[model samples]
Target: MFTIVLISCFALYFINDKEYQQTAWIVLIGTVFTWTLISYWIRLQESELYNRINLRVVNYIKIYILLIGFVIAFYTFLPFSVETKNIVAAIVLGFPILGIPVNLLVVNTIDHLRSSNSNTKYTLVAGVGDMAGTVEKHLLRHNGSHVKLKGFIKCKKEECIVGEDRVVGDLDHINDYLRNNPVDEIVIAIPVKVSKKIQSIITAADYHGVRVKYIPDYRGLFGENYKVTRYGELDAINVRQLPLDETYAFFLKNTFDKVFSAFALLALSPLIVVLAILIKLDSPGPVFYCPIRIGKGGRPFKVFKFRSMRENDASTGGTKSTQKDDPRITKLGRILRKYSLDELPQFMNVLLGDMSVVGPRPHRSFLNQKLQESVDKYMIRHYFKPGITGWAQVNGWRGPTETDEQRKQRTMHDLWYMEKWSLWLDIRIIYKTIFSRKTHKSAY
Candidate 1:
């Protein structure tokens, strides 16, 4: 499709006038190269691999912007007459806009047909409970054509909530049953309480070389952001994890942080210098305060902030929660804290790899320990790199934790952000931080 569009674009612009042919060819090649690079970068060529329509639309929009931006930049640099550039720009922009709908239609049709005619896999369910029943019903209702439900393996006859007719065998006979029957996949929908039975079924499936998938029962547990992995041949379940934990995601986010921080520090140099001078004149302490704060994985790092209070001997004073009108706050500190200018220095911390642009805000070591004691899952927020501004902060959960409920609510919002972390979500949080009216409402 890309090649066809490129050829069509070239043909449309190619004229019999030889004087302009060279310029036409140059523009055509440049446009095609830029379009191809952007398409590959955004994975538009692999759109068929995804099943979500909304994701496909987003990919198309990204490609559209890239194409238009490339055309604008390419034309701006080319030494061509205004008339020629305008004509070339129109041709280049039209191709991608025209191609998007066609590509969407082709991809959607192919996906529908592929799903409709896909080969059915023979699947068996192990264990019988609410989770098992829910899985069975979902398969029967939504994936009926793509999956064949063989039967269920009951761990205990009395405990089996699924109908007895669907029970083909018990856990004791699972190995023997697989030895005789041909099963493509085994779905282990068992609770953690019955670990021995689940392991037995998994081992049997492994010996038979059949794929095994476990459906965890997360009742009364921190079930969000669960991931399964192997640790030296032993299966391990991760209760709290983030997409940033993956190698690609970590690299992408870290690279963005470094590049953005460098740009911000350079761009805001004038403002930073002026602020530093003002801070020194307004207070008797250093211009910058580097306080030790807990970071990702509970590692301690010095967080950078402009001095916003008077010099004090109490080391714990900085860690102690601040109120709306704390007397310790200096006259100039009020303006800095209200607009979050005090956090500008932390961009340097982001450059140093001690923080991210968007994540759960880091807390002082003393406050972290106290929060951990009061909140059971308080440390879970440390699973990701601390950020200068976070989901909780943007949602008005910043500042002093005056009550147990306030601490829990803040932690809950932070955990939700971790579980739902995405590049888009990060962008949204940053946008809200800058534009939202209530952004500075909770700040002291």
Candidate 2:
């Protein structure tokens, strides 16, 4: 539709200008390709845009602005008369102003008809708790929701909070029921305390490619920003999960990490080479230290770092923390550690996909085990890929964890970071790491 509209506008503008026939074709093709790419990037085909009028309007405005910019930029380089450019701009701008509403109306009407009772989705509820009952009531009472409750899958008959007649089957029969019965969506309204059972149900739903929604029992327990994800009007939350769990968020973070790491390595090649040579000359050991550190999901990966200590430093065993004026440090190592230059090699780890450029720093296996014994949520930090620098490090939580309280505090910061992660937040951390005064204070 966009292609047809754009090409029509282009033809209308350049039909009389036979000398600019090639330019019209170029503009038409470029506009269509650009809009197509932008649509995919913003997920315009997703139902949410069509269902939410305000979102649809906002996206249209954004796309219109982009189109205007692209047209002006394209014309700036082309040998076009000022009159021709003005005509093209006027024609292109009309495409969004007039076409967007028509497109929205068509999509909205189709969606409305599709969401009728005759076309309702057969939804299955897992668990018989108050949340499950609430969900069932909501689906039944809301006519526009277009959801039909098939039945509930209870954990046990005695434990069933809802009526026995409503209980279709137990967890043991969920797979069989899903196979025999036609279920479009599965709503898991279980408590966070029974996460193991919830996980199993979710796994089954995923295996069958069925839509799964989770309603967390513990809402206020989480940070406000990390509490709920809204699908249209239905709100759900995945307990102890980060936004990165979503496909788009994961893609954004991973893409940024790869691009930034690659660029940093390229731009800093000269410095990295100088540092590597200096480290090799200062220490008897290898220039780079590849230590196994626990990364995302408790997976162990070798983290790269320029060697900043003696060949066989006792601290390498994770028995002791590096301190001020440590004798294990080489003369060149002191400077490298002060400005975090020793961590420069970790760009390689970032490029290798073992770590991120910004996240909770990874801990050695021995230290991880020791910290896990004392700190209740120490291991939660491993839920995200480890980084060369982290929120904790920038906020004065870096250096040696001399006390259990220190480790606990650092873990708290790490969890908070994961809960509130964004592209801007990562950029903020990177900026602070380079400019903040406190960043190097605890370095040894």
Candidate 3:
């Protein structure tokens, strides 16, 4: 999306002038083709052998439509003359006309290579019925050829339809069978009503650390709004999908973080340099301080900050919070903390994808564990990236989780932000972070 938008803007100027029309077209086409190839080069980042080609095509089409829509919406915010509209339309539409075919061809070729026998996953079906046969047939299909069926397992509830020679063992010995076999995944094709048997099979699969997939037979158990989704080619159901789980939301937030962080770092280089030098003069310690903090998915990562304290035990791995007029704070450090200049280096963290511009603030590892024990659903805040500034911070829940009420309120506010996140809300938080007195009230 960034590649398309950036090229469009660059081409806009030259395309408008009749003298540079050919040059503009060449630049636009060449840049886009280069990016397309780059995207293809790293396309196997997920390392999946077989891809759902239809799904890939659908995703590309959705992205293309989204790009066109974004362009139109963006143009609406600008004052465009009739000639500008024609130039913009041609630039946007013409690129996709040439790009889509090339994209599809590459996708098909890659899909073919990926679906080869070289990376086939040996799978075991934990039943021998119509559902089991259906799964076998599906695996043999063109798209699912990457999953090679090892054999079927006999079940008391279902009559064997597959050949006797294909039966690895009965469901009761599934644990033993998996322990001695090299199965990549096990598909449970039995009825959902057989709860006890299914539980036993799941336990066996879990013990053996084998991936488990189920044939969907629980349509009556869930609401219409709860739809089936895919994990690779295997169908599964989700009760509620978060906003960030959507592709466009993830792409938009990720793009905004990278672009905003890069721009902020470049623009703030002078101030950053001056501050680094002052930190060295003010205190005899490192210019940057990195302390481990709990991040997304409860993972621990070192958070970057300009050092604002005299080197001490607390400055390293200690979970202690700074207090009012703390003795450890240096003269320049106090000023930096007052206006949050100390946190300016965290833009590098944002650029590194360890943080976001706005979300729940990351807590120290010990504090995170303590909150998990004291507060309900506290860990849900870790579902997304921690931020330099957050809704809780903007709403005056920024500092010192000393009491239960403070901890609870901060977590509740963070959860609320996750549920109600939008670009506009992020903008509001940023505005308040700069201007709101409440945001700085608890800053030590």
Off-target runs (Cα >4 Å) in candidate 2 are 1-218, 221-237, 313-317
**Candidate 1 C-alpha lDDT tens digits along 346-378:** 999998889999988998878898999999788
Candidate ordering by TM-score (highest first): 1, 2, 3
- Itemize residue pairs with steric clashes in candidate 2: none
Which residue ranges in model 3 land beyond 4 Å of their true spot? Answer: 1-236, 314-317
Compared with the true structure, what per-residue lDDT tens digits does model 3 show for residues 83-174?
54565566667656655566557656766665587866889998887678888887775346566789998888677888889999998788
TM-score comparison, 2 vs 3, better candidate? 2
- In model 1, residue pairs whose N, Cα or C atoms come closer than 3 Å (at least 3 residues apart or on different chains), thus clashing, are none
Please say which candidate is ahead in TM-score: 1 or 3.
1
Which 10-residue window in model 2 sums to the lowest lDDT? Answer: 219-228
What TM-score, to 2 decimals, does candidate 1 have? 0.61
Give the C-alpha miss distance for residue 55 in model 3, angstroms: 30
| Cα distance off (Å), candidate 1, residue 23 | 34
Give each model a TM-score: 0.61, 0.54, 0.50
Model 2 TM-score, 2 decimals:
0.54
Model 2 lDDT, full chain set: 0.80
